[model samples]
Structures are given as C-alpha cells and as structure tokens.
Target: MTNTNSTKTIAVYGATGHTGGYLLAELRRRELTPVLVGRDADRLRTAATAADLADADIRVASLDDHDALVAAFRDADVVISSLPAYVDHGEAVLSAAIDADAHYTDLSGEQLFVRRVFEDYSARAEAAGITLVPAVTDSNLPGDLLGHLTSRRVDGAAEITISHHSRSGGDGSRGSAETVLASVDWFREGGWHYADSGWQTGRPPVAELRYPTEQPRPASKFPLTPVLTIPRHSAVSSVTGLLPTEFHEGLKKLTADVVAALPATPDPASDLHYDLVVDAEGSGKSVRGVLSGLDSYRDSALMAVEAAVRLAENTTKPGALAAAEAFDATDFLDALAPHGITWRIEEL
Candidate 1:
C-alpha cells in the first residue's frame, strides 16, 4: 500500500454494487486505479473483473467490523461508498474514512441521511482534517447547483424553488430502490425548508410550472435532497423542490412494496434525462434557470470521481458539506459536459 499523500489511492466501499461498478469504471477511465473494499471478496473480485480492474487491490471488511474497515481505508487518500440505505450502512464506512483521515463522498439521496452525516460527522471530520460530502450525484447536486447559481443572479434572493424531472431509459438499480424504501419516514413526515430566519418543517405546496421543454409540465412539491443541500451555501430563506405527482406516488408505492427488487443496474447505454429548473424570488426581483443532463448514473459517477480527485489533491475543504459548498458548482457541472450533461442559466 502507498502512503496516503504519496499516491491517489481511492478506496471504494460496496464496490460490488451496481453504482459502485460505474464508479470503478469511471475511476479507471480517468487512468486512476481504486482499491475495492466490500464485505464479499468474491463479489468484489467479480465486479473488479467487469470494471477491468482485475489486478486492483480488493479489501474485505463488513460494516460491523469497525477496525477492519478503518484498516481497509487507512492508506487511501479518498473513499467513495455506494452503500445503499445510508442510514443503515453508511455510518460505519464514514467512521472508517474519518479514522483513516481520508476524504469521503457517497451516493446518498435520502434527505435525513444527508442531514445526519453533516449533523453527526461534521465536527469529527473537521477535527480530523478530513472532508465528508454526500449526495454528490445526479439525484441532488444538480438541483442544488442550479439553485445556488440562480440565487446569485437575483440580489437578496429571499426564497427559491427547484423543480426536478428525470426519465431513465431503464429501471433503477437495486441499491437506489433500497434507498427509496428507506426514505419512507422522510416522505411521510415531510422535510425541512429554510424560512422565517430559520429552518422549518412542513410539506411544500404543489405548483405547476413550465420547463424548458416546449410544453408546460405537471409539477408538484416533493422532498428531494436539494431542500437540505441548497441552504448550505445560498442565502435564500426558503428552498423547495418539486417532482411529478405520479412519480412521487410511485415512490410511495415502492416504499410499501419495499421487497420488490429493482434491476441490478441501469443499461450502460441507457440515457438518463433530467430537467432542473430553479426560480429565485426576492423583495422585488426574480430569476430563473434550467439545467438539462443526460445519463444520470454516468454523470453521478463522474461527479463523485471528480470530487474524489479534487479532495485527494487538497483542492477542497475539510468537514461535512454539500457538493456546492465543497467545490465550485459551475465548474463541477461544466466538467461533466464531455459525459453528456449540459446546463444554462438566464434571468427572467
């Protein structure tokens, strides 16, 4: 093993999972090799082969094995975890990363889990001089970035709302399905929105808005991670995100029938489409913006890998933070252009 500062060794926990496979492939495509860490050595080996990382180091460590996980990540400069339902398996991996003093990022979309990481781990990470960021993926960061940038366009932006719509050519991964299932309470209990000089809890009101597309689309209030992530940097007083009603209903159904397995992985060639719209309103002025992207999973991997690389190079700050807080949002978004994602912002 190489010393943490001497090499860019990235350790991937849950490397056998579907999203982890994409992460590994993205790392390799950047000419960087990642150390595969997971509970099952055989499964890790298989995934490594599929990612063309057959000769890369594979470390086995269960979430219950605290010391082992720490040891597995000890020499890594960065650790990217794809562990699903982060509320269950993420804490251990996060602890191990902090113990190793390695930067950490994950594919977490659950609002509560994202908040918990910052709430529970921020102090420890800050003390250890380690950076910890979650929801560094397609599901959250894109909207967060749009909101932050739009807020900049409108001086003294008092409130902001971001509407998200996504369509995938194939089914979601089992890990993603598991995450949605674990978020039942979050959906049921509703979520936090910045307002009245502080955070408040309640469901956001439903609203219909026209997207950049030719026709107006149906949009309703939905609790996505951006509601939590946006307030981390922007001065906006309120943040709300909305999704399609039927899609939100489908998530509720998936939560009830949690046992129904999702497809192992999205089609590699499948195009994941996204429309992110941000509206910021202030005392008398307002601004709106939109970002369209393709291949959610691929862009997510690119985002995570880019974050890892940046953190490894000491370009990002230490402590638990939103993606925009840790990196230049526009630069990060622009970096993924080669991966089939693009964005545009305009005043209204």
Candidate 2:
C-alpha cells in the first residue's frame, strides 16, 4: 500500500499462456514495463518474441518454489497472475506479495479459490495495506455492471442471469479448459448451495431465453465468479449464469474428435467467441444489458493486465478486493469498447 507517484515495474506470471501473451502486449502498448515470468525459459522466450517484448526482462519461477516466487516479485510494484485457477495457488502467491509488500491481482474465476482467498488472505492483505484483487476478468465484470444498474434503480432486483456467446474466430487456452472442468466438478459436488438448503448435484441445462429483438435461444447453467460476487454488491437475491451450448458442445466434440487433444495441451485458437446478457427483474419491470464480443479469452487477459496497470498506477483502490469492488464497471466496459466489444442496454 505504498502509494508513491512514480512509474512502477509489474511482473506477469504465466506470461507464455494465451491470455498472458495478450496481457504482455497490452502492458507494452501502455508504455509500461512488465517482467515476463514462467517456469520454462524456452516458453518465456517464445512469448517474449511473440509479444515483440524481447527487450523486456524475463524471470523463471515455479509456483512450488517459494523463494523463486518471492524473488520474482521483488522490486516489482504489482504482480499479475494468469495461472490456472484450480491449482489453488492464491494463498502462496498472496504470501509472496505480502513478503514483497507489492500490490497483487489475478484473473481467477474459480469459486473455491476465491472464497479461500477472501476468508483467509484478506486480513494479511489489509494488514500489509496492499491491494489483492482477484476475479478481475470475466468472472465478476458482468456482476459489477449489473450491480451498478441495480444501485441506480434500487427497487431491488429479484433475479439476474448472465449468458455468454462467442463469435466465429477466437482462441482457447489449456488453462481455460482446465478451469471449465474444475468448475463442472465444483457444481457436481453440490458446491453451490443457494438460499440455505438449496444444494443440488449437476448443473442445470440451458433453458430457452427470449431477448428483446433476437429469437429465443438456449442458455445452460455455467459457473461464473459473479455467482459469488454479485451477492456481495447488490440487493439482488439470486444470480445465475450460463455458457452457450454451442461452445460447450464444441469442446465436448473436440475432446472426442482429436486424439491429440490431451487434457494438459493448450488450444490457443479454438475459434471461440463470447457474450454476456444480464437480465435484471425488479420494480415490476425488467431490463437487459448485453455484452458481446470476439476473442473473449484474449479480452479477459487484456482486462486483467489493464487492471494490474491501474492498480500499480494508483488509479484503483488499495487493499484486498474483488474485481467488482475495485473498479467501476462502466469505466472498464467503456475501455473495452474500443477493443471491439459491443455493449448494449435494452428495456424489456
């Protein structure tokens, strides 16, 4: 929480991954220097070349190595982690950030990891006075937007649903696939218990939803970070989310079709796209906000990088916080519009 007005160095872990590459590029575009970090020196070199950041400093560190991780964060003003969510490495990373007394942020959308960090790590972050922000990407951004709308309209929302759809050309990362599987396991284990005694196994199937102008489309239950975040922000009692069956089915088909598609392999170009539709029902009326875009996975990575830059620059809040709480939803969304994301609000 040392808020000094000066240019600061930021370190990016998993700098070779799909989102990591985009983040590294964004950092360069903003004229901010970022230290690329990963376990593999060769992959780090490849990423540096791909991002045209060959001159940027690079560090090699494994998450299991505490000394290495701490050394990686040394002298850095902020650290952005694009690592896999299920690894549950936030605790260790937070500890390193604390030891280094540097600001920390991540792009994790996993519910269990998020809960653990909020409950167990918040105090340490608060004590260090360093900002530990998580789920700053796809997980909580939609919820933040919905909360902002509800805050202004305050008749109190009854329910909110967020849906995602992808366009024809984009990419997927192995980290994203693993995250999806972990989320499925999370729901299947009766992890999401709503309203006391509402526990159930297996996620619900996508149901048909009617939009203002578009034809009815199927939206299936998808695990999103916002399910845990929106409750902390608005009077809304329930939050539900879905991933387009098109994407899910496509992944399923790919798994069965490609013999080389190992669970550990990265699919950086899966031709994926995504959109989010938030329906707020309150005040005896309902309205919907739709956010559609190409290259959602890449966009999420860019958003995380921007957020880390903002944190390092003292443009956002200090202390441990979630994505929805740390940044203004409208401002963030507006920033992305220039990147080819279409955000629209319609009355229903």
Candidate 3:
C-alpha cells in the first residue's frame, strides 16, 4: 500500500455518488491520494471537501467523451469506479482505463455488464497490459472468492450454489435503488446461471437456501455476477445464485415513479448486513463457505479500494479477471477480517 508520499495515483470514477464518497474516504484513510474524476465539477468539489481532500486533484470527464475520460485517467496507476448501474454506464470508463494504460476495478453487480467486461474487453485489456476486474462489491466478491475456496476443498465441485441475504436499516441508497430498477427486467426473470454446457436463463425450481439456524427457504435464481465470473477461472460446471423470490416479485412491480421518490443516499446511522453463502458439493462430500459483513455499501468501498491498491502493486495477471482470479482467495478474504467482513469454510 502506498503511503502519503507515494507517487501512485488512484483515479476514482463517479466521485460524486453516495458510494463514491465512501471510496474517497477509504482511499484517504489508507494514506493514498485519489484523483476525483466525474461528470460534474461542482459535485466533485463537494465530494472532495467531504472527504477532507480539498486539495486532491479533480478531473471533469463525462462518460460520453471517450477522449476526455482517457485524459482523466492518464496519470492514474489504477482506476476504481464506484458508479451505480454499470450495465448502463461501465464500458466507457473501462475502455478509457485501458486506453490510459491504467489497471481497473469497479463495484459492479450487473451480470450482463460483468459478462461483457470479460467477453468484450478481455482481449483488449490483455493486449493493453492492464487488468479490468468488474463486480467487486459485496454482492459478488465474497461469493466468487468463496466459490473458489470451497470448490477446491471438495477436490473440485461439480455443483456450486450461492445464496445472498441482505438487511438494511431502511431503503438503500438511490444508486442501489436505481441499479435494481434499471435491471429489474432481467433480474426478475432469473438472470443467467451456469449449467453443464453454458450460461442459461431460468434454470429450474426455486432455489432452496439454508441460512444459519433457519429452515430452508425458496429463493429465486437471480443474476448473481459470480455465475459469470467463477466459470472464467474455476472449473465449476454448474453455478446458481439464490435471492428471495419475493424480491424479484417486488421488482416486477417497481417503477420509475416509485424509485424517483427514494432518498438520494443512505442515512448516517443506517446499518446494512450482508451474507454470501457458498455450497460446494462433489465426491460425496460438501464444503460450505459463509462470508458475512456489515454495511454493503461501506464494505464494497473497502473491497474496490483494496483491489485498486493490490492491482497498483502490479502483481496480478493482466486481463479481465475475477477477484479470486487476480488474488489469492484465502489471503484476500482473510484481509477483510479487520473491516468487519469474515469468511469461514466448514465441512457439511
């Protein structure tokens, strides 16, 4: 990790959003400087002030202007995007980062976008010698890494199931709301899951999920980003992600008007709890890995910033990668322990 005087620069895209504020604060806390790059100059300045980085470099670049985005990241060693709805607005920054010769990571949870990053940009990123890792948030990071760890424990998993559970003190931030609303059509349809041959949509019966001390509940198969990520680096033939079926039903009814009425950000005291459970089974044995954390948004920031810092060290292989593919699964998960995020693997 770079200290106060280190010359490594991290460029943060979407520096004006709610999660952007957390990313900037985390970068500052780690004694690394952030170059705020976003579409709005005034909002960037405000975010800078709020992060106590009033003197930090600020670059104004809209996503539409590819050249401008490239210029904004020209001096950055790594670019970490905290933008919401990556399915709608991720490629520009990703393209720009490769153009600027900077490694990239983002807090994307969109399966479509995550798939595109690897399929569309993997060759370009590899040719550019820069890493591009998407879906590094609480939603997918733990699941992907844990999928890697638990699968190995069973000597190679033939089937892997990931379950997601989240608790928030209130409605989440506007960005999260927007992400859900924007992707509801696909999300509610039981987005892509890996099967024996390839990616498939609408796989089977509702997923049966077992949380701690609770009876199995039926969870809808959701577009968990890891379904796309894990297959890239792991040998899992089947991967399924489970979320509350009710959540998908609710999204079936969500509308722009309803989302517009939401608050722009989470309250100062609003607490968030997230659990990512991975069940790997094969060879008449099973391994379960549970990754639990507090504050999805805050922990996501930590995950992205840590990815940037680690990528800045230039040790990971360059190309479109998953969190586990880029770093040691066990070491990376263990590193998050101090941040109120923990992972444990046990025989079942």
Number of the top-ranking candidate, with lDDT as the measure: 3
Q: Considering TM-score, where higher is better, how would the candidates rank from best to worst?
A: 3, 1, 2
Tens digits of lDDT, candidate 2, 30-80 = 887778777898889888888888688888888788888888888788888
Off by over 4 Å in 2: 1-5, 168-171, 187-206, 211-214, 245-271, 315-317
Q: lDDT (0-100) at residue 109 of candidate 1?
A: 74
Count clashing residue pairs in model 1: 0
* Alpha-carbon deviation at 161 in model 2, angstroms: 1.2
lDDT of each: 0.78, 0.67, 0.85
Tens digits of per-residue lDDT for model 3, 1-348: 222335689999987887888899999999887899988889899999999996789899999999999999998999998777888888999999999999999999888888899889999999888898889988698889998888888765458888877765235888887887778888878789998768998756654788766678767888889888888777787998888666776786688888888888877666578788999988888889998998888899999998898898888888899888898888888889998898899998
When sorted by lDDT, best at the front, the candidate numbers are: 3, 1, 2
The Cα error of candidate 1 at residue 163, in Å, is: 2.3
Ranking 1 against 2 by TM-score, winner: 1
Query: TM-score: which candidate is best?
Result: 3
Instruction: Show pairs that collide, candidate 2.
Output: 165-274, 165-275, 166-273, 166-274, 167-273, 206-219, 206-220
lDDT of 3 at 48: 92
Lowest summed lDDT across 10 adjacent residues in model 2 is found at 192-201
In model 2, the Cα lDDT at residue 157 comes to: 50
